[model samples]
Target: VGDALKDRFDGASRVMSNSDHETSVQRNDAAPHRIPRKDRYRFQLRPHNPDHKSPGVKDLVYLEPSPGFCEKNPRLGIPGTHGRTCNDTSIGVDGCDLMCCGRGYRTENMLVVERCN
Candidate 1:
């Protein structure tokens, strides 16, 4: 079955290629010749950069206090007391509960801190 299918596919491809409008091969009107049959595969040609690229969305890779952990430690806040110095607090959320925090607090929502100068 596979061999027969492969033969038919090759024949179809040969017919299509010969009838292609843009081919550079000049059709010879000379004596008839039996063209040997050969099995081959065809693959689509893709441009380096596709014409239509999907738009990118906001990545959750940086979201903190990951949604769903606990309730009591719900409201999340920045860690610090006074405008003394930059605290070395690293917040992390645990699986199953929304208890996300480090050093001293947790928040109900994820926090993102950025400095503008």
Candidate 2:
């Protein structure tokens, strides 16, 4: 999905009309201004797959650049961790600190499954 979102910038698709903004700018006497150029949207992917030592956000959400991420071979879309839940007091990986990926994150109340014991 990250690739698809990026590709939308390189094509004339109506999926995102608000994306028609300058990707970069040039400098002129210390001032910068928009300059048209071939654009490429750099993206990274982190997947939550089974068999991996840590498959849940609680274990993988505390990384800055995610030292060991799979930019390729994504089993899930790149909406990425935006929709994943987090623990309020997560001192480790699964907190807002890492789950937001520095881009920050927003929250919403929703239904979740719990073990019925």
Best by lDDT: 2
lDDT for each residue of candidate 2 in 43-96, tens digit (9 for 90 to 100): 232333333343232222322332332133255443456667876568668987
How high is each candidate's TM-score?
A: 0.15, 0.27
- Could you give candidate 1's per-residue lDDT for residues 64-101 as a string of tens digits? 22443223342564332322222234332332122322
Assess the local accuracy of residue 92 in candidate 2 as a C-alpha lDDT between 0 and 100.
Answer: 69
Candidate 1: which stretches are off by over 4 Å? Answer: 1-24, 39-44, 47-117
| Best model number under TM-score | 2
Q: After superposing candidate 2 on the true structure, give the runs of residues whose Cα lies further than 4 Å from its correct spot.
A: 1-79, 109-117
Task: Give the whole-model CA lDDT for all candidates, comma-separated.
Answer: 0.33, 0.47
Clashes of each: 11, 0
- The local lDDT score (0 to 100) that residue 102 gets in candidate 2 is 72
